[model samples]
Target: MTDQLPLERLALWVEKRPDAVWLSQPVNGQWHDFTWAQVDEQARRMASALQALGCAPGERVALLAKNCAEWFIADLAIMLAGLVSVPLYPLQSAESIDYVLRHSQCKAIFVGKLDEPDKLAPGIPAEVMRIAMPYPTMAAQYTWAELLAAHQPLHEVHRQSAEQLLSILYTSGTTGQPKGVMLSAGAFAYAGSQSVREMQITEQDQYFSYLPLSHAAERFLVEMNALYSGGRVAFVESLETFASDLRHVRPTVFFSVPRLWTRFQQGVLEKLPQAKLSRLLRIPLIGKLVARKIRKGLGLDRARILVSGAAAIPRALLEWYQSIGITICEGYGMTEHLAYGCFNRPGQVRFGTVGKPMPGNELRIADNGEILLRCPSLMLGYYLDPEKTAETITDGWLHTGDKGEVDAEGYLKITGRVKDIFKTSKGKYIAPAPIEGEIAKNLWVEQVCLMGSNLDQPLALIELSPAAREQSQEQVTADLAQTLQQLNAKLEAHERLSHFVVVREAWTVDNGCMTPTMKIRRNVLEARFADQLGELDARQPLHWQ
Candidate 1:
């Protein structure tokens, strides 16, 4: 693939297929398609408007919105204008929003529909220019229509080298403050092209955009891949309409994190009892028909590629999907690497391992068992944080915080995060992820977080599934005790759990327990439960709260 900027590719698509739909957004109750010409025209006008507002080249321009069609347009416009796009998660707190804006020194921000517009208003500086998207929001100086009508379409696209900064993607900050990751234009161009080629994505493939665009995985995988391959991208309206939207789009390619994948399985199990479903699937011909019907019902029958990443998925969950003829390929990557580190290719399938490194990408395990990667798509550095940047990238290799090992077949299996390993009072270190993954295999367990720190042994905080929550407490406790017994039997002495505490409340983004990408905020959860852990009896095998 040539080292052409995404905007250059968009320009080519506009010239070749002006009428072809590039983006689809749900409005009111129906889906609206935006053609390549429309995207180009709007992005050009957006660039012109930013230029009129005195946004200079290389200056940061923030885009704060949920997953929407305009988010992509704003990103392209920012790149076209030779400005850096700083995408902020819509669910970011007011404090985080202010911190990112101040850190990036963004001169202009494109605001769109948000869950809490009031929280955002106080964060944006009065001096910063605000452009509202099509969504109804009064938190902007100019609406999209007004800006397009007032400004002239910019005919000249700014030529940029591969090393030029494209966007500053902030980390989800599960442990500490979010750091801005500076990714170059070449990184996106290279990663996008590689993803398109590796996944065999083409203009005919359709992608559903439901994950936050601010995330590196979704941005590079879905948005950038679509831009590079001329694929159509469909945006989900809201969580309420997700199932309907998925059914409507029936996208050829689908990617989701492990949490969402588990939820999907839970949804299916809720409708059909697992025991009955398993019994039916034991039949030969009827099993195939049932599996196909089940896949169609989930709107994934048409999906040629189904990927699960952002976090490790349970092997049980992967096997469950595989039983239905859908192989969920688990991938491994990070924001610092443009999410192009390694992915399981079509035929080289591994159940738990995230397949071998992509073409031209180097993956080597450090002496400490941490994964080290060297790739063209690696980030330039962490924005304004030279010291941390140096710690992350050394000797031309990105030090992935994840601890993993490459198997004999070259497939990488992630063990856990280095920082997530907690030491017990006995001085033994335990990797919580594996234990958590094992506990999650029990269908009743929705979310599990293992913590020990200074405690004598590891303890588990588990959030039960909705179905499990409805069951009698005694029955739930008994099932969990059995599950814990099975899990502990396979674990080493130090890795064994002292007790399993049933968390009454579910962890959610709204409650500050989970990141926008649905990853549990370990620091937050640990802090919240710190006081209670001291009082819990280590002798107890199970505790109901």
Candidate 2:
């Protein structure tokens, strides 16, 4: 079983269970199912079309789309045609899109459902071939149905060597330009096979695919795991139908980012007040019943493995879910390693730590406390940027760039980013992650960034939750001041916050304040509020901006 790569695994599944439903996509309020054989046939036909269109073997082809059945088929077809796959973020800016297409020199692009096709159209160079998937997307030279009808299934399965380049997944840049991480076919094969084995995933399990598949974490979780385990994968049709689509799937294995998990909790609290929920949970037998009902309502009643990644989730959020019989295991990984690193196994999850290294992975702390990881699935290198790759990878261990400490029991807790540490005017260095984590525990705060950097005292730039924004500013301010005092008591004098400035604008992907994967771009936030924060330093403890 280990000898077979992804395409071989796909062939095995098709031969073993041709009629088994592998992909379920929602369109226009209707659901469509694609069996293993259907996916196999379509991918083969497309692979033939790509070859006939003059795409040479080992060339790059780009996939720009939302997560859907066709995205999977296009990726599979790329592999079948002996071409390397490059995935661009669906919400990526036009400038970034043009940069990647030009930098990678992709021979063609497969366009699918985009939020604004017109905004992305100009990014595609005129020379690159355009193929449109079966969705409302920009004009293309060839259509999905037209190609499938024009070509026959390519009988030959392109055999890829284990060391061959599989895909170039451009990072959703939070700091600088997105760099393509070159991963081998064996990298994902190893990570996915190991993950499924350790998590006890089986063919009977179901997977939900809503997160951006362009991100390594989501691709490893939803697509790779389903491929290795022969599980069926379902997708969300649109943002408006996310909740309903999630409930309809009830995936046995589910993964979400921290932002969405916080939103889920807020949704519950809005319907049933926290005070009422606390009371209902305190009753003995009724408490169990209430917890079960809540889990069922969230469609996580059947979830055997629920994971949260892309950013650190608050311990308070995890504890809240635990009270409701939902165990949200927070793991750690990066695009550089295909997101195959440390994980909190179901029976051995630690609250503050991303659990121990997996069986064959190595972990150590640098002299400066940066976490270093060496795994079998580490990327070959950053695409066409060996200087940057050399700076990142040394002696086979990927420098994670995040500061962390490990307990004697081997649990790893990320402290902060080495580059993110800031110094005060008084020359005291402070790590903002711990302080930010503490601030995030407050229910009223949606997002917070701690900044000081040569200032007299640190200040928190916060965004209010929707519910908090509705309440009186007086009520919110009073609560924040009390929480701030409590937090200051636990901090060094220089590390204490001076003010809390509420940001009026949202930090969304559209505005470029956050990455497509939903991690806040700290540099962008700081640059946006640097002047305002300095002006408000000597003002009041709290202000509504």
Candidate 3:
């Protein structure tokens, strides 16, 4: 084992297994493989070409693209050239992209094939070198082909120290502007290696990459883990073909957000309406055969690990997947720690709790019940913001804004976000996230935003399922009303939702309702729907009936 960090790890792997497939992309209805040697050479050329453009050490290079082979090549090249890499969420609005680029002072950008580059191009700084990859774009930018053609490789030299800044990930805050979390090369390498151990990743494991790489969860868990373990990584062609791509890859280790897992649960449930179909299929003579068929059709038959995170997953949803012979392990972490904080072990899987902290990581509750974490993987600080950084990181503990409690066995049970909890006019503090997590168990309720902040009662904004909307409006409303009544009974008076509004549209990253990790933007949703929720107060709590 060498002392080389992550970038060096990639180079060493490529040198050892030059011809091994490092990445795969779907092309012409087939998966195309790119060997390790190919990736190494491509990234080297890109780095050298970037240097020719006067890119300097510690300068930022922004990558705006989906999960493609080029994304990884560009990322590695950035670090290899002793520059910082800032990955933008691919589905971000031009405005958000411009914000990140400007905030990070990115000197160059590498964008993937986009439907509309002109819209995003104008906002970028004129002095920045814009390079579009694997697709045609406007003339001011250099195509990826042109970038490589301009390569002038440098002699072998390791220019990075362990303490050098690796990347600056911008995460939205509850307050005014977003904060850029500055992380070091040591942080990524340490966390990535620890993840490989905790997740039990191996060279034989293949990963299907669909999640946005801009999110630290996917970047550390999938992208960086692939480099650490030499596993073949495959990118889905598009969201439309995600199912087909899964079947094609038969990936051993699969990662998804809680929302996607809910959809999968709902998709499976769609086949069996309300236990009537389940009863018919559960007969001793047919149960095994039917269950086997269901598993095979969903392409989950070969999946060894189907991990979900980036948001709290409901226990009810986990039980639903368990019934289908799929174990959904839910973990918890954030961008500041290179993502892996706590995860349940394979067999010791527990529902509703983010299991024991990874080795070398310590978790504790602060005086105010906020979750505090201490780890070598913790980010250095907020970029150029010493005051905010000092406030967040005190005495080696990263003050995670989340409130959690540790059980006797040391499992961390996330209660709610300290900043997100709303106080009702009744003087009762209600945490809406747990209630939202429970209501999300309803298959027809696709995505939910629970709002009550400084209000008398809470209201839920529900994005209905397609199947739910296909029913007559009266029937859809009736069923959801019944669900709300039952769910409300389980909550305290202040915690119960006063009314529900069903939205036909889905909350997605492209729409600015969700983040790159598929986490609902609470502040944005609250601002957008505050008045609409206030209108719900006219009706009584049980008025939905």
Candidate 4:
């Protein structure tokens, strides 16, 4: 905890190593690197520019952008001006964008790189001030170039105190309205400094960031980590150039959600079939060569630490990555605690458990099986919602709402969500996560959700993998039915799946069936398919929707 607070750390870097590059961004086949001195100068200028535009200290300022050098600069500028930052998701629907801006009552917003600038333009209130970044964006009254030209760097900067409120991060809602999680400077300092030491992160490390900075994981694990550890960060330009950009960065520490990890596996398997890959790995000399080539191809050759979070990854998937000499460490945490919790340590990798809690976190299981955590990095509270905040944190303990089991050696295995367990009409309770995890191991399945509320038996709604969709329907169905039968043998009578409703529609963030972080919205899917699921009969076990 002795590491300097965020602002102080930035100041230290600016003074100690002004010439060192801190951020780089790829754009249109060119790389833009920003040194510490440059970042400090721009941030200082923007801070003055904000005050000149009638923004007062302590007012909320929003940032709407994808990951870029300017994104980091704008965040630091917000802090420099003594303003609170509210980051909006780059690809969020206009409705969500509108809701957040209104809910936060933002005084001004800094616009930067985005996917659909025009589509999200209407979300900002016309009266609110708009400050555009260097990149093209929706029309704004103030531009980065104009601001830098008009104002000199502010001589005085806001020195942050540990307890001061830093930002309000709205949780990417899986079911209900998104609540703003209030995090203080101390939270970031605690988590960032702790993680830097625990992971042994140093200035020599490199970070590749693509996930939404609006989400807590990316903000904490990537952005804050870079600032605290004095590491260099590179951002992807576009979806089309993700592979090339990732290859170019060849990051030292990589963080990704389970969805992307799944896609990476699919991409590798598509090029080299599993059978052929397995055969190549059997040879002593060729195995090492083949594994190294695969790592380089995936742009993870230099990544000493590969992390997966935001959802539970299947054990079989982890095993597959292990076979390729890549150990994907799956961790567990939530936005309420700034995403600081249990994690599988590097080199001491565990298979089925998210490793023990970090040094300062306290973990305990409630009588009802819910996991409770208490830590210094826990959020101050939800913004303007005392009742909800009170309910979430009681006696200094945060109710995680997730059920888990910890082994004697302190490893924790998430069993299921306390709210996700449902009882069938036959009075048997089912936890869908373990069942869904087992179902997801099948090659034909891409995503699976088990829903059965007051029904005779739980039914599975499955999204087919690309390879499965290319196969004949009959063959796919026959293979899936056999797989279902084998899976049911291991479950209790009531827990056995009654139907396999193969769905063609993919559940994605844009479709409202997934959170921005890519965790499936179970409640949304359950309600969406309620009628279709009810129409099932005992006549057949499988059907296509």
lDDT of candidates 1 onward, in order:
0.89, 0.92, 0.81, 0.90
Model 2: lDDT equals: 0.92
| Overall local distance difference test of candidate 4 | 0.90
Question: Whose lDDT is greatest here?
Answer: 2
> Candidates' TM-scores?
0.98, 0.98, 0.94, 0.98
List ranges where model 1 is wrong by over 4 Å.
Answer: none
Best-to-worst TM-score order: 2, 4, 1, 3
The better-scoring model by TM-score among 1 and 3 is 1
In the range 368-406, model 3's lDDT, one tens digit per residue, is 889999998899999878999999999999999999999
1-545 per-residue lDDT for model 1 (tens digits) = 56667877888899999999999999887888999999988999999999998999989999888899999999888988999999998888877888899989999999987877986689887888888999966467788999899988897879878888899999978867889999998999999888888788999999999888899999988998998999999999988889988988998989999888888888888988899899989999999999998898888889988888888899999899988888988898899988988998877889879999998799999999899999999999999999999999999899988999889889999999978888889999989988898999988888999999888888899998887977798898898999889988998988888899998888988789998777898888889999988888666789876
Ranking by lDDT: 2, 4, 1, 3
TM-score, candidate 2, is 0.98
Q: What's the TM for model 4?
A: 0.98
Clash tally for model 1: 0
Which wins on lDDT, candidate 3 or candidate 4?
4
